[model samples]
Target: MNNLEESKTFVASLESLEPMRDFVSQTGSNAGLNKKQIYGLCIAVDEIATNIILYGYQNSGIDNGLINIHTIFEKENFTVILEDSSTPFNPLETKIPDENELGLPLEERKIGGLGILMAKESVDEFRYEYKDGKNFNIFSVRPNDD
Candidate 1:
C-alpha cells in the first residue's frame, strides 16, 4: 500500500513534549482525522513520549538521549512509531487498573498505569516492542466511520 510519512528527532527531555504533540496533531489532521480524533492521537503520543522522557531518559540518568518519531499515513490508518534508546521498556506490559481499582478513591489509586491506559485507549491500536537496544511504541488510529 502507498504511504505518506514524516519523521523528526527530538532530545529526550520534557521540553520536547510540545513539539512532539504538535507533530502528532498536524500529522493526524493531514491524515483526515477530525478534531477529536486528532486530540486523542496527540494525547496518545504525548503520554507515551512523556514516559520515554521521564522514565527512559531522566530517571535512567542518561545524560543525552533522543526520541525519534515517525508518522505514516496509509490508506486505512495513521500510524506513529516512537523510538528511543534510553531504556528498553514496554509500557503495554504495565497492568491496567481494573474496574474495582478505578472505582477506588482518587488518593488510594496507584500512582501509575492510568496514563498508559489512557494512551492505549485513545487510539485504535497500540503496541510496544524492545529490539536492537531501542524501545518502539506504536500508535495507530483509523478515521471514524460515516
Candidate 2:
C-alpha cells in the first residue's frame, strides 16, 4: 500500500492518452502489480478516455474539455479515477453489448457501448458517477498471484 495518490489532468484529446498510459504503468508497478495487470489497467483507462475524447464534448459547446486521471495504490488493490468536465454520463448504466455484437467488425457493429463494455470487463470493479457537472469513473484492479 502506498500513501501517495498520483494524479494528472490533461486536455481531452488522443494525444494525452500516452501520458495517462505511462502514469498507469508506473503506478501499477509501484503498487506491486505484474506486467499483465498493468497492461489491463492501461487498456481499461484508454478505452474510457477514448470515449471521453470522442463523445463527451459533443454538443457541449466546449471546444476543448479537460479530464483528470487519478491513481490510488493500496494494499493488494490499485484504483484509477477518471474525471471529465463534460456532460453527465453514467457509463455503468449502459447495457453490455452482446457477444455477437462484440464479434462483429467495427463497420458492421453498433457504435456505442462496446468500448465501455471492454473497459468494464478489464477491471475488477467499474463504477461511474456524476457530480457537480463532472463525470467520474472509478476502476479498481487487484492482481492475483495464483
Candidate 3:
C-alpha cells in the first residue's frame, strides 16, 4: 500500500451505489488504469458493495449502516478496500458457482453465488475478512502495460 489517503464513507443502501462506482472509476483513472481495467474494478467493487448493502444491512434490519471505502496505490497494483459494520458473513465461504451449475437454466440455478463469482473474476485479486466487528472486502488489480 503506497498512498492510503484516498478514502470515503457511504450509507449502506442502494442509493449509494452510483457514487461508489464513480469513486472507483475516478480512483482507477487517477491510478493510470485503462478503461477496461477501470470498468472491471468498478464492477467488482459494485457487486460486493451491493451485497453488503442488501444482505448485510437492509435484510439484516440494521438501519443506518455505513460502508467505508479506501484506495491504496502500490507500485504494481491498485487496491480498493470496503469496510462495513454488518454481521459476520464471509462471502468467500459461500460456494462459488461452478461451470456445471452455471450451465443450468436460470430458474434451476442458484442465485446467490453468481455475483460473487463475477466480482472475483473481474479483478486480479479479491479477498474478504471479518475482524473487529467489521467486514472487509478487498479488490486489487494490475495496470496493463501500454
Highest TM-score: give the candidate number: 1
- Evaluated at residue 82, the lDDT of candidate 2 is 94
lDDT by residue for model 3 over 1-146, one digit each (tens)?
A: 45644999999888999999999899889888899888888888888899998899989999999999999887887899999999887888889989999899988987868888988898889998889999999998887544
Residue 60 error for model 2, in Å? 2.5
Q: Which stretches of candidate 3 lie above 4 Å from their native place?
A: 1-4, 105-107
Worst 10 residues of 1 by lDDT: 137-146
Residue 143 lDDT (model 1): 71
Find the number of clashing residue pairs for candidate 3.
0
Better of 1 and 3 by TM-score: 1
By TM-score, rank the candidates, best first.
1, 3, 2
The TM-score values for the models, in the order shown, are 0.93, 0.86, 0.91
Could you tell me which 10 consecutive residues in candidate 2 have the lowest summed lDDT?
55-64
Report how far off residue 95 is in candidate 1 (Å). 1.4
Ranking by lDDT: 3, 1, 2
Residues 49-134, model 2: lDDT tens digits: 88788778745666778889999876667899999988787778878788888888988988777778878777888888888878
The collision pairs in model 3 are none
